[model samples]
Target: MKKSILKWCMLAFLLISNLAVFAQGGTEDTPEPGDGTEPIDSKLIWLAIIGIAFAFLYFANKRKAVRA
Candidate 1:
């Protein structure tokens, strides 16, 4: 039980730690990637990729659970 709790705590810490860096990135005055006129924004693409990866992990785990 302690090991399972520790594992979840570590996962939560890693996720929160990574997101904390994003919170430091931009202010309302300046914004990220400079002005609003940029043709391409990589952030959206990266967000989508992360979403897909999370979905994949969720589905894979769900399948394992269903089989067992």
Candidate 2:
């Protein structure tokens, strides 16, 4: 149980960090695309991908649980 809680805490920390980094928009390394002024935001795309992955996993687990 302690290990599980620790794992969840780490996962939450990583997710929050990723969100903050993504929210900050393009950095020096990323630079601006063609405009050279705007910072492109891609959090929505990231969110969509995460949502789809979560759904896939949920269904997969449900199926496994049903089978077992």
Candidate 3:
């Protein structure tokens, strides 16, 4: 009976603490819209993805050859 009461007390404390955290607003130093940043090149991104795919295929074939 004591253990059950202790568990309920701990659970209620945790619930109240979480509600207090959620009630707060964001800080004053948060970033505003249109913060200056350049976009990345899509061609370079695609080239890196293709290179990774080729590497995976090469290793898979090498492993299969070793098994045979």
- Highest TM-score: give the candidate number: 1
Q: Can you give the TM-score per candidate against the true fold?
A: 0.41, 0.40, 0.39
| Candidate RMSDs in order | 6.1, 6.0, 13.3
What TM-score quantifies how close candidate 1 is to the native fold?
0.41
Q: Order of candidates by lDDT, top first?
A: 3, 1, 2
Which candidate leads in lDDT?
3
Better of 1 and 3 by TM-score: 1
Ranking by TM-score: 1, 2, 3
User: Which regions in candidate 3 have their CA more than 4 angstroms from the true location?
Assistant: 1-40
Model 2 worst lDDT run, 10 consecutive residues: 24-33
Candidate 1 minimal-lDDT segment of 10 residues: 23-32
- Candidate 1: stretches off by over 4 Å: 1-40
Cα lDDT, model 3, residue 36:
50
- Clashing residue pairs in candidate 2 (N, C-alpha, C atoms within 3 angstroms): none
* lDDT (CA) per prediction: 0.84, 0.84, 0.85
lDDT of 1 by residue, 1-68 (tens): 99999999999999999898767544466446756745456578988999999999999999999999
Q: What does candidate 3's lDDT look like per residue over 2-55, in tens digits?
A: 999999999999999999988857667756655853235646889899999999
